[model samples]
Target chain A: MAASALSPIRIDDPADPRIAGFVSIKERDLTGRQGRFIAEGTVVLRMLAAAHHAGRGLAAEAILLLESRVAGVEAIVREFPAEVPVYVAAAPVFDAIAGFNMHRGVLALGRRDGVSGRDALIASLPASSLVLAACGISNHDNMGSLFRNAAAFGVDAVLMDETSCDPMYRKAIRVSVGSVLTVPFAREGSAASLIERLQHEGFAIWGLSPAGETDIGGIPPAARTALLVGTEGEGLPPAILESVRTARIRQRPGLDSLNVSMAAGIALHQVALINDRI
Target chain B: MAASALSPIRIDDPADPRIAGFVSIKERDLTGRQGRFIAEGTVVLRMLAAAHHAGRGLAAEAILLLESRVAGVEAIVREFPAEVPVYVAAAPVFDAIAGFNMHRGVLALGRRDGVSGRDALIASLPASSLVLAACGISNHDNMGSLFRNAAAFGVDAVLMDETSCDPMYRKAIRVSVGSVLTVPFAREGSAASLIERLQHEGFAIWGLSPAGETDIGGIPPAARTALLVGTEGEGLPPAILESVRTARIRQRPGLDSLNVSMAAGIALHQVALINDRI
Candidate 1:
């Protein structure tokens, strides 16, 4: 059986050709990673395995782990198909290959495949749904937090503009707690174009901003709604805010605004509650 | 003329005696800070100056700057009394002293003074007020986010248990965007004792947990309301949850809980809105 065929291979050398994809992970995170990404730690590894088993268009190509963690992760590793290789290395070799001290000591190489186009993802959602659309979300932490919040609130899908950072980035996936692996998402086109598509599908769009005209609480629940958020300092551009219904979360005067991800989480909770999704 | 007396001092050595407080900042952040904290970046530096001028019990003992940034922050440095020395160093010396590449080029030594006692802080609130109470928030980033949410929602004061991390930690202060300076807060004592004092003040306490009996939205606005939140994974202890009125933010079934800071922000916004504070 495929399950019985699983045996972790030992890696003594950091420069082994078989583990090339796992070398200098920190550097790979910055330079273009093509369609491949890294999933770190046990929690994310389990999520990757689950996604793979469910045929969610995310595949685990291979895994590299510290020798000590091999026994602990044996069950999770068994979930993957036999074709997937699991490499175990001592701390010295693992750290050398990663080019940094990897405290978690678990890593998996994943490839993005069969992801839906923006149009198809939007069209696939039910008539009544909650969506989070992000624009110019350049920071990976905020992007990850956004995905985590979306999963917690049962968001049908997350849409990002071309300027948004890739959700598949290692830090983003880790921050999302692997939500990026399970949640349906698409990133492409301009913010305005994405908004136009949602509007055509009879979705009520609410752009979050400090200067929004209507208070966020005052936004009535609708059949289908999209909570739109933007980058930290330069919020949704003037044109995008003007294109959609904008709402503000009232706050004390003179203080800097809430972190963008926190603001979005608050807004999503309210919308999800009123829409009865949670 | 204190303003004219404020002259920038140039330091050629990383081991300069005058700037002793700013040396090995990263190391100091983990070890004891002796009531002293570092404020970084232009935004936080401005806030520190404002706190000093307002006599809010936070004083800037010294200022350190990269030689290149001295010109830009001269105005802010002038806000401090002449007794507060402003030291300028080249990138190499500054980086060596900081034990890391100091990207923002601004740092200030601040001392906390006249911070309110738990009883004094609770008793000082008006008859009708909103407050945020945190229990076991050990993460610096989460601690900072809690304070930011408190300030945004106009919470009267923030109360933390002994187990919670210090809000004055350098990273905490930076993450809070200086909210830790302006907000009225007290962190000491056990979580149970702190909550008892709030109850004595006739404050309605709502402990947030996923298993909470009441939906957060269902919480009625009261004259004196305090929203209590716990750490990320092992949420509020059962004893605490059983003691207070419990509320939960309804969410999807299978996903991990929201980030502690994000969850607190959502609940705070709800309470603040119902109380007409926002």
Candidate 2:
């Protein structure tokens, strides 16, 4: 069988300019990469390749792989346009370039510049939609899990407030298991304004909090529904919780609240089941 | 106000024999800890203190605290018996002893000799019970989350197979928000035997998997119900999945499965709500 139409470019130097975008990934994770982000592992690479092939607003800028892995992902690599370079390196070079041990040995540069705008995404939602909105979720793992849950439950779109970290962050993307690439999400504005816009669009928004008055399961399914989650310790701001209808997952009387992402999954599952969207 | 009835001892040396149990915590995590385990942060320390006071079969052997955090956790420290030594150190000494940055400034060595055996714990469950069983759940974070979810949903007891990782692992306890200390759990036997024993106890078991035949929400609530989840990618071993009545959280057709912990939370919440436990 043929290896494929795509050519593999060998990279021996950790300092190779061709693989610059993939360098010092851990350090680059903290500093913004303009419009580019890193996608790692074969699973995520497959997702990015599929998204690019399907023209789903994300494009693969390039790919870096351990030479041994090139054969395994040839089918996925072939999905990318010919212009997108695929670089392979030895273990030492890969480790040195990434500034850490990357056992997975697969990385890709991606562009989110084509992501839809918040208003545009909101306007594009169907009349009957199930959506997820995150507020003040700064943890990358939580952010990724939120997207993964949203995708698993077939949420129509995700809206993030300004205080929330980028789901495109490397760890978040890895946590989301590449749902970040396929899930349509827009990050802009403050939590309050985002809530206001969703309300204006005639969506019933339910902020998830321990103090929530209504049981999440008891919430009546609506034509358009959105589940809002906040940061871990301090839940949704009191005002925001008050502004929207609130739902709680009942728990034992004296325990710390469930992890933010865990709560999101439960709430999303409940809403999706009631709405017949799952 | 008086700081506490118990006195604090100061230790300047990182290698102090008295603090051996708390040394190189990261490395110790890999080595078998015998009956000893490390609990960090004020939250877990408080949980340990309470567990010890309640005669829950767990005890705080000793505590190591940064000098600065003593005031904040004075009440918690006081919860421990007067005989338990409390050691205080400066920041550098504390970090050196821990073999890492000890930002939380609190640590406790605990013993879990009192945890009930699987059969004993199972026999102790009330006539009506909601329990969570884990199969091949090796990741500490997921294990922690499972216990957290179990506690939140008012599960009676958690049963883990021999193949599962210890819930007492330092990171798991922290990730569980100290649920591991409070929740009653027994790790023993193989997955098949655990299921068989639960079935013999008249508990209707639901193994959570993507291939599960019934929607999780559709499972009829039973007087004794147990929810079982496996590792992330492999899910429940095929033999185990086939051996038990299976249920799934309905998700999008083609996406990857939800993180095992997230899936557990969703299933637990569903069963808890149905059983009127939460």
Candidate 3:
């Protein structure tokens, strides 16, 4: 399953600048690259390859695999274009380069082509589309889980505020199970701007909060719907909640709100128009 | 809010035997206590205190709080009966005791009163109740997230497989946001046995797998239903999937499957009789 036009490169030096993107992964996680992200594990690597092949602006600049793991992922690695280099490192060198155990044995550096274009993406949604928008979702795992839910319900796109965490964060991508690689997302503008823009596009924006006025289950379906999710503890802000229709998942009282990702999934499933999706 | 009957004792040494349960917190996370578990944060502490007051097995043995955070959580501490000791530690001492930076600044040693009784809990379920059964869920966070969803949807109880991770795992409890404290669970039998028992109890046993033969949304609501969620990759095993009524959350074809917790939430929202719950 090896690619004929390109052969795997051997990475031996821990200080090699060619592998700079993969070094100190924990620290790099805190400070992301210009427009690049790391996709770890076999599943996420495959997703990166798929996104690269789809010509969707995501490109695999290079791939680093454990010497022992190459055979297992040969088919997936072969799917990448010949120009993308696959680097194989001995287990010890790989771990040293990554600054951790790096047990998953697979890592790929992926770069998104361009800058944020929230308004353009908002303006481009077709009529009768389902979208998920988030405000102040600063947690990486939460953002990743949200993307996974959005993808499962066939959300057309995920829109987040400037304050939201990057969907490309490594932990977020891992938690998403590579859904971050598959789903399209835009992170720009304020939460209010996203709501106003969706409303302008004739999309019904529903803010999901525990104190919402309407039950999410019975909310009437609309042609184009946007499910708005917020951070776990402090849900959609008051002005944002009041700016759009607010709906709460029907749940037992006395406890705090549902975890944000669970709430997103429930809300998405309700308004997702399943027949059109699956 | 200074629990008049009990006073907070100042703790200066991390090596004190009185707080043995709280030391080596990380290692203790892997190897659990005989019947004790640590509950962190103000929210979980409140739940543990509530469970203690209700005399439902869970009792707060002792508490450790950062000196700075003691005042903010005094109301919750006072809720605990006078018998439970409250310990205050300087910030440095508390962090040293936890083996990490303990930012939330609250930890309580909670003890379950007795051993596992899976059959007893199943027997006690109301004629019309929603339940969640987990099979092969080894990941602590997933178990924790499942419990959180169960609590949010008002599930009567969570019955897990013998192989599933313990809900009382420190990370699991924290991820569950103390739902593990409030929600009752039993992990005593094989997944097949759990399913079989639920079926015998006149409950609708639905195995949630991506390969499920039935669509989750259109399934008619039942007086009682049990939603089964398996591990992330290899979902409900073949025999178990075949043994119960199989239902799939409709999703786009290209993706593999939804995160188990998200799937559980979506499925529970559809099958749960929300109006009757709250």
Candidate 4:
């Protein structure tokens, strides 16, 4: 529990160049990032530290905390690698640097392994695994909730296509309660290739739809099952539905469908229960 | 589908006083209201329209639609009562009136059956019913998703404690895809009284938790069941958990719990399936 890994740096000026990566987070989230993303709140920061501690393809470069929060979170902060810098600033200075009021008072800068990092990570999962895949999930909250569900159900990894929102988006990471850091995820390629690669990996691909021939409840347990979900409005693309085995959640008729994240949660829970992984 | 019930009204000025209720919507949501809330997006507007048509205690007093969207939604417009006015405005004008960019171009001034309306509605549900009880669900998204799941699982009603967020909140209604209008809900009294009243009415209350003894999969079907969910993080208050028969949606150890909405979906689906209602 010793905090040997971090020497708290005092930042008095919000304009200090050292903390520029966190400036104007909302705008930066819209435009792509330069391989860096913000992880907000204490939970997410801990996840980043844990991932870094485990060498699970994500590392924390720095942490910024409101001066008052430092005392409360010091024990957790000490767990990060010694090389990772920790900075503390007054509330005003921290708000100035962040370009908004950050009530959580804890933020971390996370760096993924590389562009192809998630793909390589996915290729390394064990034979018995559960994965939650996102095809066109662009909403940050949906992206985070999906990961949180995946983690709760013990899914091995989360695979996302280019159309999906970044799992590291600050809002997403916060919404996931830092599950984005705990759950492994990769965002690469088109939906077609993502599906093809999973099938080639000896995984059974089950795309969730409202009109599947068989309900998700009856999808007999399997060793490696990849549950595919699409964006909210239009569900999984026609190509993916036709190419993979599609299963419906059996929601009552009349309503369109459940929210994408909720659907994933239900489907993942069923899969985990069926496989006795829970 | 004839729209003889609704007559189109043309609006050229953004500050036509007729649309003041929608101005500065974000702030208005926090302050008080005159039994009115803004319903945005086509899906929610349609729900409002349906509620009005069915005399379900909700009515559309007026509609502010972008002139361009009028033709596309003509079929839906005709479903409303002829007294409900449909106001068409230029996008710029609508944005000015709303004090923000109204991208969806469909906004309706909805008049609910007042605070006591939903309470009376909830009291009127049948002897055999499936209801969703929200104790401390304060998040708008979670509230909306709960309503959406209730609709999907054929839950008869969504009853919220006074601490819960307003289901009529614009974002919640949109997230629920207008299910907030279709499904009956009442946010009144304390969680204790709400549960007591449901118990008095024959509801077998099942509080969802991560530490419960009975697994959600094992919850046998009943004539009347009320699934209770609390806010994220704090979960259901200890008082409620101890008083009711709690059940857990089994998940892997170490993880805290599933998202509130996700848990509701899984539990509702399980209960619905057990009852042979789905």
Across B1-278, the per-residue lDDT of candidate 2 in tens digits comes to 44444468888998899999998998889877998888999888989988898787899899999988889999888888888999999999999999987439999999989667999899899999998999888899899989899899999899999999999989999998889999899999998889989999999999999999998878997999999998778999888888889999898899888889998899888888888887
| CAPRI class assigned to model 4 | medium
* Candidate 1 interface RMS: 0.9
**Candidate 3, residues A112-190: lDDT per residue as tens digits?**
8764388887777777788999999988888988988888788888999999998888889988889888888899889
- Looking at model 3, the pairs that clash are none
TM-score of chain B of each: 0.95, 0.97, 0.95, 0.93
Off by over 4 Å in 1: A1-6, B1-6
lDDT string for model 4 (B80-156, tens) is 87777788888778788777764488888888864445457567888779999988787888888888999999899
lDDT of 1 by residue, B4-88 (tens): 3456788888888999999999888999688899999888999999999888679999999898787777788877888998888
Which pairs clash in model 4? B3-B78, B5-B81, B5-B82
What is the docking quality class of candidate 3?
Answer: medium
Q: What is the lDDT of residue A103 in candidate 2?
A: 39
Indicate which candidate wins on DockQ.
Answer: 2
Instruction: Give the least accurate 10-residue stretch of model 3 chain A, judged by summed lDDT.
Output: A1-10
Q: What's the CA error at residue A203 for candidate 2, in Å?
A: 1.0
lDDT of each residue in A167-240, candidate 4, tens digit only: 88888888888888787778888889888888888889899999887788888888889999998889998878
RMSD (Cα, Å) for all candidates, in order, is 2.6, 1.5, 2.1, 2.6
Return whichever of 1 and 2 wins on TM-score. Answer: 2
Superposed Cα deviation of residue B211, candidate 2 (Å): 1.3
